[model samples]
Target: MFKKTSIAFAVFLTIQVHSAQANAQDQTADIQAQAQAETEAETKTENNSIEKIAVYGVRQRLEKAGMLSDSIMKTEVISAELMQHKNAVNLTEAINNTPGVRVSNECSMCGVKRIMLNGLRGEQTTILVDGLPVHAMIAGYYAVDAIPTTGLDRIEIARGAGASLIAPEAIGGTINIITKTAIENSATVDASIGENGNRKVGILGTGITDDGRTRATLIAQYDNRDQVDEDNNWVNEAPNQDNRTFSLRVSHDLTDNDNVIVRYANIQSEVFGGPMLGNTFADGTATSVAKVLSSFDDIESDMLFEGGDVRNNFIGKAWETTEWVNTQRDELSLSWLRALNDDWNMTLSASYSDHTQDSFYEGFSYYAEDTMWYVDARFNYFLNESHLLTFGVDKRSEEMRSHSSGETNPAYVSDAFDYDVLGLYLQDTWQTTDALEINMALRYDHVQADFIDTSKPGKEIDQYILAPRIDMSYSHNEYWISRLSAGKGYRAPLSFFETDHGVLDAYLGFEIDVDKLERSRSVTYALSFDGEQLSMTSSVAWTQVDNLAMLTKTKKTDETDGGVPLLTQLDETATVTTADIALGYAITDNLTLNVTAERFIYDTAFKSSYAIAPVEKRLTFYADWDINGWDLFTNLVWIGARDLSDYGYDGYNQIDSNGIVVASSKKSTHAPSYWTLDFKLSKAITDNIDLYIGVNNLFNYTQANEGESPLFYDLDGGYDVAYIWGPLRGREAYTGIQATF
Candidate 1:
């Protein structure tokens, strides 16, 4: 069916192109005559008195109204002004409020979060900084929240497969963080404090050389938040975090048509969660069993196990219930752009990143180090007046090494591997007519991966992938526009962390079947309308993934050991279909209102144990009002229910050591829907300073309050901490001051 549709679409595009070319040729004489007439009339009016008419700030107004974008790919932009209104301090907080996008918490204990685009898993999405693929898989676990929003100009989001030309692994979508390039002699500082010991301070500054050829921008931020245990179970629902980030960007104009940019960034973070304690386990304060058990109360102690014998079995492993992670990341990137002539231009870019993590989970200690680099070269040619061609080559490589040790077991190396991908792509932008445009792209990637383990023989895998994409845009009139896109993309699975949580047992090792590749195809259609007072955008997308990678525990049998986990591909296919609509209206010159609605449908032949269940429906409403230098922003979000049984979260019976059922968890087939409200108000105290206050989750809505626990115990007394479906934190109020000089 897909092949047939593709063939038909190609035929239709060909017909449109031919018809446009014929029409252009036929109207050549008319266009020349009109131009001549206009010239003569202009000469006649030159001597007469002329009246000048000027219009200002129309584009800015449209952008503020959320109705202006000039990309053929149906991109969405989260502007800095919008981020300030929402009181966002990081990338995760900025994009989570956008339609058709979600950031979900994977681990309740450590507060591990991932972004889901159009109902796809986070690993499938490619995150880029200034159009460079410098975000590594290991860094992705925390970078979304760690990256500060100080020096950013905006974030560009494109959904569906093949959304990026250089990053072929973008099976879900792409997010590009664009930084400020034009420099001015200005500096801004902001500080805020909130509940739960939350506090943040940030500074951003930009400067230009006297010659006006070189410029630099610097940003630094520090953020800290304490842990929260709302249910008083001694198990924290949110982790305590201390994070610091620094970034610098420098740009130089070498010639009239040549420019170079250099960027460096660093992040340091420490996170602690799980059973509450007086101090960090890393400080040796809670390393002993007695110290660990002292933090728990009688209710928590009784809830730890089904019976006394089961509790006794875990006497010396009390430390296993806690988690701590320390992470550090550094990155550097360079880009050069030069125009050979008016018709030819090229770009050269490269980036390198290093990430390291030391962490312990459930009594197991693990350390990981990852290094990655990317290089890209692109050339563009203006073939004719209506056709432009782009050719590019990209090379990316990544290496990771990890070690794990249990409470009583010695440390052993695990998941030590490296992979490289070389890609070549060609894209063409054809302006069929004044009102129509189309882009067609094709990419080929060669991948090689090697797995190294001293205890076993090394394994190697090689694969090749081809991806194709097409996008079409047409303007019906000045106010109405439409777009359609389709693409095929693939990912070469090389690491166990891509599919499962980063948990390792000291005695067990992973066996990966790298013979198959994860592949996907997606189609999206969007229609938008822009007017004086009202704007609307509606889109629908469909995506299907084949050979999905899944981590499974081997069954114990006489033929082999069963407790070891392996990474394997599932035979069934997984699919997601989503529809989204957004509307914006200017109620008055100083007030604007926006509303968005999204619906998602998920289908799979097999159940998943770790993946977040997709929400079926979501609605959001936002209001912005500015009065006499005082601004107000408010939003209400409604999240729909999810099927718990679909993700292996069906309630289970708790059995004691004597093989007797002590308790049974209820079968929560469908989670309840909920709503949350947020508000921010800012006032200008002086010409250079502003004071702001805001509240998040104003109603104090949480999953625990809704009778759903993120931590669930199975029949054998083993607990799972991934059963999260809704918000974990309650109401939080914060106040801050911003100053510019």
Candidate 2:
């Protein structure tokens, strides 16, 4: 998307800046504390919920809101108590502190990020908002960006195939984001400004009107800064970028047992590559962001020259991505609490979602729109006070299109492509005893995608996929808990197959479809111990992929196919394995800390892509303190992940004499350890106004690239580290004031 697309575009073109900030502080320990609060009362006759029994999703886990993770089913919840008090920008970074989870940021360029649940890659994790599928088929691997942290009321994480309640393909795990619910009347407004010209504002209000219940929230955030590519490199250190996000939501209790909810959100922005800031002659090559910044011992002189030079080269190569993301979601829930009955109840739910995406890179643009529907019903009957039989069924349908210039797929090549899918599933959750419980589920899907190449139109893909899953949990009374689970999942082929991207961070180098890929096995084990003000949790999980699919240029059917190479997903590469672990702590009523580490070992034979991410590890620190009308917190992270690959192909940069493309195995370079730290402070000045102040990248450390001068040196500044390693955003200061009625 370009700057001229909206008034925001004009602001982007005129302003050139960057940001160097780490994510929010870890607060899961706080979550463990809130979960201890038992639900007691209900709303006044007006509308309120009294804290009653706080059993989480246990009794009905994997039953309501598509919650796959619960006792007997294996899941975790981080509610509003944990979300509201902290400064969280995205889910990826926030979930990093969750046990057995990792925010594997694949590329540091142009929104290259994804959340890895239980060691599974972005493609393996399914994201749901209020029981509805938000990421379907082609669009996967978005954690924080798609959701505004402020709007979320709670987060539910389930490990393994999500059984049948969700789609059957949640082989690794599932994370469901629950939005705020209905209420009599409530209003909240948040506004803050931080270091590096950073500013953020949010407003949320909900109430029961004459007709129905409604809740709404709006968030506006901004960050701008300067950076020096330390190396005498051509790439930028921290390219300049700006962003804005807006969201709205409403829910209503229509009838005795019927309810409905709706949500809408949009995020738009412009990003200038710091690593892409140098001169290039068509071929991709360069120094790094770290190198450019390191070259100047004399900060003043270096800035004058480095600033102008980078701008000239950068603007010339400024590849603009003008994009707009719009989503419309609807959910309907019906529950039969009881009718002249004792311990029997049934709940049925249906949801639908529509997504519209349009992106323009350079002068070429790509657009795609997709719609999906989901239906689920569950019946629960109590055998006794200590046991219950819960069972259900689920189904979904999806239709999508990729369009440009006007036609479909490679046909208009510049046009759009379309496809459709239908799926069905079933599952059950059983409470064996007060101490033991079990959950089981299964699902099947049939989908067909088409490429409308008006020219040489030909059928490329058609497939039906099946998936199944099961899980169990044991609670040693109320203080100790354990869970075990397993499941199967798969990804069918699509028409746009092995295609191309207009962005640099586009991994895989081609389109996604090669051959129909399916994963047949899953394993997950987790445990938790809770104390009055302290809590602990640990988990281990693994997955195996069968009949994996990948594209290989070296083994192409016809090297002379003119680079439009023949591609297919095969059964040869199969069985990829992965595992993960985590821990958390609370020191005092005012302070909390958490730590989580994860590992991914790709089974070489399967070749499903993630191998390039290396043995990744993350260590985070958090501390929140309130004093004299002020709220302060500090956050830091130390990350280490290494790739074992070594590049050997020679003269690979040169095209054939006839301009034909030649290829070699994708190579990943070494990425050393990097660390970042940040801190924030907020003050309440009056009944109607408040203030926010903070510093990001407190160390001013960044991956070094480019050069402020010839004498300086920056080893960490290169595009190489972007995918494998990351540098600090650099030190920045910001301040802002907010008002309320």
Candidate 3:
């Protein structure tokens, strides 16, 4: 692995050197011209008699507040500059620092991270790239960590139902990742290494034609991390991962009023965890239960069952404790923009994605393939100088198939699904006055789904839905703004992989009985203040979801067949309420401080299948300082506690090898609160080079430190690997260097 990484780094350096040599002359001339222009501007300013206020990039807090106040709905932006300050390498690490957003791991073995918005699960959020829904179910499961931050310009977030015009399934919120547009010639490379065998490297390049009509950008990145086990149980607490990604984008002007953009991206990733022995045997065959149990002969018996008797019984079946997954994904997208006249404009876009996975989970072998296609067309018309009308039509189609084989069950096919949706929407923005604006929109959708399940009869479903939204923004004064919004949204049933991938190991098969669409209604109110030295924003929201899908397990009664479990869903209702506040103050010309606080309340009838409980309260503090040529940043986050018994995690029944209950152990009901601190420092060594160092989780805090383990056993002696609520990894220090030419 080290040799390969070295070779790749050498190639990247060679490319950068060649490009620098080619552009050296042009760069020198541009620098001289820029200095001359600056000198002339300074002279003009000195000669002028009138006084004027100067604006600087140091006042980014006020600028960001202005962006939020001017939008029709509440929106948040995460800039690339902030990501750099945090020393983030992937999308998950960057977004996790933002207020009102939570990223949690769903599986200890696979390390599948899920993004939660406004107290809702990851499945309810719609993730997009450049306003296109190319990250489908299978790919989305891993995209959060596989996507590199090398070429991102910014990220836009909107929380609520019907926040996007084209995506109707965004019951929780919408996240849009925007890429940078190349307008100049530049190249950048970054590399970092840390504890636990962590390593990362990335390169970004942008170029524009001399005619100023064509632009292009390219990015490549690689990341790897080793597994960690703190309890000395020969089981990993954190999964091992290896990821690689590449992307390219190009834009061209075909005519004076027409432009086209094309983009392509590819990702390959692998994850493994569980027993320390690895995923397979020496001969590349599946490891049997006897073979795995024999490897533990040297360990003491008491250490194996320290948690409880149920946990001990689970440990007896060693074959059901390992997991491994390998994935490959490719995406292509295109967009065309045309101006019909001064009052009318049009846009057409299309995208396609293919994802494939090969995996081994708990003595089972599962393979899957998924493909998606999407198209969109929209037109905007300016009417009477007071109103702007926008209308669009979009269609999305997806198909997924999987094959599975296990020790107790015969080889069979599962999760064969084909789904299609067509949507049409119209929106009008009316500027009633200079201080007030109103936006009203409506959308209609037709959904169709077909499923082929071997455990039960095939099923087909067809449905139609209508959604409406309205938003009003009023400027009370120069420094104050108030906004109100209400909307309705619906979501179609998703594939099995999107719901719970771990259930595949425990269940023989699944049945589809969903008869109604999952629907939601939401309302939000926000107030903001943007001043010279202080800025503040606050919001409150409520959402109610009906026909929420929930899963249930059923056991086979026949003796001839193994007593395997089958899974299905039931319709239910859930409600969520949230309140958030953020404040920023410029303490000095070179220092800034910020604080954010949020609270969430949930009323639901079903427990999370992944054993994840919502956090009730959270607070974060941030500080940035710049002195001389050095920059420093610090962050602190506090997470509140929850009642575990309320989520059905009270205790587990002790069972012997013959499945006989003997005793029970009560578990801790109340989880304690915890906090973490991070710090980073960077300085520019030259005009084109920078050096940085950082420490994450400075206190080396983890759940194990609090005597709480993520592994838990149930009444039936089946273990759950997703009982997590806090950080699993400890402190780590890293240093890196960046170069630009």
Best by TM-score: 1
Candidate structures ordered by lDDT, highest first: 1, 3, 2
After TM-score superposition, the amount by which residue 224's alpha carbon in candidate 2 deviates from its true location, in angstroms, is 8.2
Q: Considering only N, C-alpha and C atoms within 3 Å, which residue pairs clash in candidate 1?
A: 320-363
Candidate 2 vs candidate 3, TM-score winner: 3
In candidate 1, what residue range of length 10 has the lowest lDDT sum? Answer: 14-23
Cα lDDT of model 1 by residue, 369-390, tens digit: 9999999998876677666677
- For model 2, what is the C-alpha lDDT against the true structure? 0.46
Alpha-carbon runs more than 4 Å astray in model 1: 1-71, 279-318, 406-413, 454-460, 504-506, 556-562, 606-610, 651-663
Q: Report clashes for each candidate as comma-separated counts.
A: 1, 76, 0
Candidate 3 has an lDDT of: 0.68
Candidate 2 has a TM-score of 0.70
- For residue 469, give model 3's deviation from the true position in Å: 1.5
Model 3 agreement with the true structure over 392-465: per-residue lDDT tens digits: 89999999887766423443325678888999988876667766767788999998777765553544568889
